[model samples]
Target chain A: MASPAYIAVDWGTSSFRLWLIGEDDSILGERRSGEGMTSAAQTGFAQVLQSHLDALAAPENLPVIVCGMAGARQGWVEAGYIDTPTSLSAILTGAVSVPGQSRDVRILPGLAQRDRQAPDVMRGEETQLLGAIAADAKGEQVVCMPGTHSKWVRVVNGQVTGFSTFMTGELFDVITKHSILSHAVAGAADVPADSTAFESAIKAAFNKPALATNLLFTARAGQLLHGLTAAGARALISGTLIGAEIAGALSSAGQGAAITLVASGRLQTLYEDAFRTLGLTYTTVDADAAVRRGLSAAAKAIWPNNERKS
Target chain B: MASPAYIAVDWGTSSFRLWLIGEDDSILGERRSGEGMTSAAQTGFAQVLQSHLDALAAPENLPVIVCGMAGARQGWVEAGYIDTPTSLSAILTGAVSVPGQSRDVRILPGLAQRDRQAPDVMRGEETQLLGAIAADAKGEQVVCMPGTHSKWVRVVNGQVTGFSTFMTGELFDVITKHSILSHAVAGAADVPADSTAFESAIKAAFNKPALATNLLFTARAGQLLHGLTAAGARALISGTLIGAEIAGALSSAGQGAAITLVASGRLQTLYEDAFRTLGLTYTTVDADAAVRRGLSAAAKAIWPNNERKS
Candidate 1:
């Protein structure tokens, strides 16, 4: 492969992050902006990029690559989603070409499932997993990435085999704030990572499993009848949903696969603790690392000959 | 009392429907408008009243009584909520005067509950319950008002005694559209509501009770293991939650209470079926009818001198 410089970008629902690198994969100046997919609609694509590019003092003509919601139908360019059991190269092949004045902008395609009888799709996370896989260089490594819509992806030979989405973040918010579960929640305050209360909640929910619903009722009934505080009850409900999410993800990936957990914020801590409770093994990787790698994967794809070698 | 006609407006979150109610408890004229609470911040308070008043051909200076979200903290007048066991008259007596309005517009306060450790407040549902209580004229009755945020209220001696709010509609929408529950739901264009299926879901959820979460998992597992349709599974989840809501309301109200059921749209049908499932002895009333009675109750309070014989 001919040596060439690469650029990477991780664009999401509410935030945008970009990076510049060389043929050897050494990092250059990196930039971030609040111009996520939502605000990008108003801020304009060119402006969000310019603001960050200007700050980085990087050449605009570089073959810029993008991953995440930026490729969504509402985003800058609809790169589309690569179907399941497809390789990262398939996404590169499907990239939506965005004409950049000073540079070549290519939006990485996301992954999708249309034949499952239910058409579901994803874009950004696959790029992250590809980066993780490329970095790991290990065989049969699975990546569990947590977010508003958490994903459990399987990979083999630097190609994403398959993945499933879970609306864990949204569910947690809803159950704790809007549902009967809110009555038992202690307060609006965040439950500390690996806290006994949260850990206990995880254990109870996964253990009894059937009691999840009845446990929800306890949020209200506990406060009124059993004198459980709203905050505590909320935590209990959160623990249950999250624990269920972990179980759901594991079941989707199928057991016996090696695990690599890519996470951040409180969820990672809780998930780690849950892993111990369930007697599972995992390697926790920082979320940003995978995202950066995701950006690199896209960069290496369009300008294949320019891809950096380790 | 001073020859001034008192108007009671049940200005909801989405619509502004007012009663140009007379002190003698007679409707002079009624007005409707698309302008609601959300648009109030832009339309201006004076304009909101003028637009509605113009439709009814009523004078702006009339002693206007307002309930519902229109009297929320950010409403035309921030009339606070009264505690439980509150009388319609007591709330009217504690009305907060709106600023800059030439007319004497008394925005009747809603209800507040600090009886629990944390304070919980409610506004619009209070007036609807007042209307239901007034219309029934029964000593003790429970009003099962269904909506996005459904409220189960207890009225005793024509007063709102206590109540609880359920995020039923919101939860149903979230689950069917956004969660694993969505996997089970048939597209609206595809499967129509089947009561038998609904009944079966309720029985499965309530029978063993603890099976609610397991039942939810079945939405995913049934699709994988048993080949259950996502649409059908969604229906089951819908049936279960609604069934749980009905069970929750009935249990909260306890026995030996006269009950009135209030709802509209598909929710009305679902709730009706749910009430039927529980064999509840309830008096069914149209949503609009209760709102008018609620307005009439508020009007009767401040304009007692012009009271009409029922």
Candidate 2:
């Protein structure tokens, strides 16, 4: 078996994923937990990282590399942000070293679009973007990294011109669990996906994005007036949010820019469905693979000598 | 004092307000409580009503006129709905008498816009609309009732055309309390309204309604990037939601329809500010008075004899 070289972590707002990379640039061990920034902030980020490393029985002096909220102002150490229109390769060089650690540790900085009117910031996803698109990629590309806060980046040639963050997933979550629509979506999880309802909602919201909230109300009204099932209501809510998000994202995209969707699991499926339903052409990239590759790129750039086989 | 002729009540989903009307249509007594349909449904609706009535000590034979969620399927009694293209006066005649009640008690029917694409139903707002706009109102009138579920009703002449329900207020609430943005607005309640932040957000959202969810995320990003105050974050959330709502409402309105804003208290102030910031002409009406007048209108239509001097 190959020896573990370094540990890579994607510590987000509410989730933590760690991968042990071998000297041959292959994954040797992996761990995932709910101790993202929110949890780690209270429990201590260094302690959390050490505990995970202990579980994997990592080498005593194994170096660690982290991307995401762990580098946020409130995280382990504020790695700060690299302002756009920046090159994808710039992220590899902007890694900030964590001081006072027994072993060498570094965290990648996030990307910030400081447009006064549409100010936006992102963490962890920058690394994912780095791996998702090639360093010398040509032409206009719209990269979508969908999750709690979905990011839509506009990359012209190799430069990230700008990006917009839509609170689609979090809004859908909070709306379902806390809004009056909660009652309408009860028992939705027990039922299958309502494709018709979902498709129609996507179209409706895409056509009239201004009516997004109005369309959300129809989730309940549809049930009350047209006998729409709980599953249908849930799908309608999900589709409406995703639909409006796409509309807003595309509205600012460079004309004829090819879409590259970077997502995994349920979000990937939903976003793919949404793009198809809206008659928009797009390609998909596995978010997990993208983030891992991004971390690998950073590792190779920072510690070139560590990549040799044992 | 004039003899009590009847009792008028606006029993909503989460609130209960009752007024004792004299023979001359004067308010002899009034009662307000949180025993709305939700509470009343759990604790017997009749018992709740009787307790409030007992407090007011009304005449045994006094007829009662009720509106709002008390007429909902899950409310006190199923008063059903009056389909749209309905006359404002039709609401007064569509009151359903509660069976098994000792005194004559009638619950006004809600309005249902059974448009397959945009199905909507409003139990309480229809009454407010009836009172806010005259029976013989001329031209195109856009009635904006801002609340938990803000209603924007389109009335042509005296007939109801259609209405859109925007989950603006409710979205603002859930997003603030349950989403990641909650931390951004932690101490907002302790500070004064951030009008500049509010107005700019309104303009941004109004100009591009599709970017509403994106704009909402700015509340957090703004706090982090620009050192925006908690009050600024709160105002930004509110303005974005309201801005999107107004844009959607006016999008479907007639070319020259006058906007009538029916709201009370903080909502009234916020909405008025939103309208003014947008440079839109609008008239204001107290929501409390509108509902009361609506109940009174229903009472007169049902019991004409009870409205005259004793």
Residue pairs with colliding backbones in model 2 are: none
* Number of the top DockQ candidate: 2
Q: Write the per-residue lDDT of candidate 2 for residues B1-310, one digit (tens) a residue.
A: 8889899999999999999988776889999999999999999999999998999998888999999999999987899999998899898888999999999999999999899899998988999988899888898899999988999999989899999999998998898899999999997783238999999999999989999999999988888788888999999999999999999898888646799999998988898999999999999999988988898888888887775534
- Regions more than 4 Å wrong, model 2: A190-192, B190-192, B308-310
Summarize candidate 2's per-residue lDDT along A5-24 as a digit string, tens digits: 88999999999999999987
* DockQ per model, Cα: 0.06, 0.85
What's the alpha carbon RMSD for model 2? Answer: 1.6
* Span of 10 residues, lowest total lDDT, candidate 1 chain B: B208-217
B1-310 in candidate 1: lDDT tens per residue?
A: 2233667777777778777765555667877876778787678867888777877777655677777778876677788667767765567576777777787677777776545422345667766666655643658778888876677777777776776665566567666665545645755433326566577777665453333433454555445434666556766667766665565555557666877888666767777777677676777777777777776666666666544321
TM-score of each: 0.56, 0.97
Which residue runs of candidate 1 sit more than 4 Å off their true CA positions? A1-4, A134-142, A154-161, A174-187, A191-194, A208-214, A225-231, A305-310, B1-170, B173-268, B271-310
Indicate the docking level reached by candidate 1: incorrect
- Poorest lDDT segment (10 consecutive residues) of candidate 2 chain A: A187-196
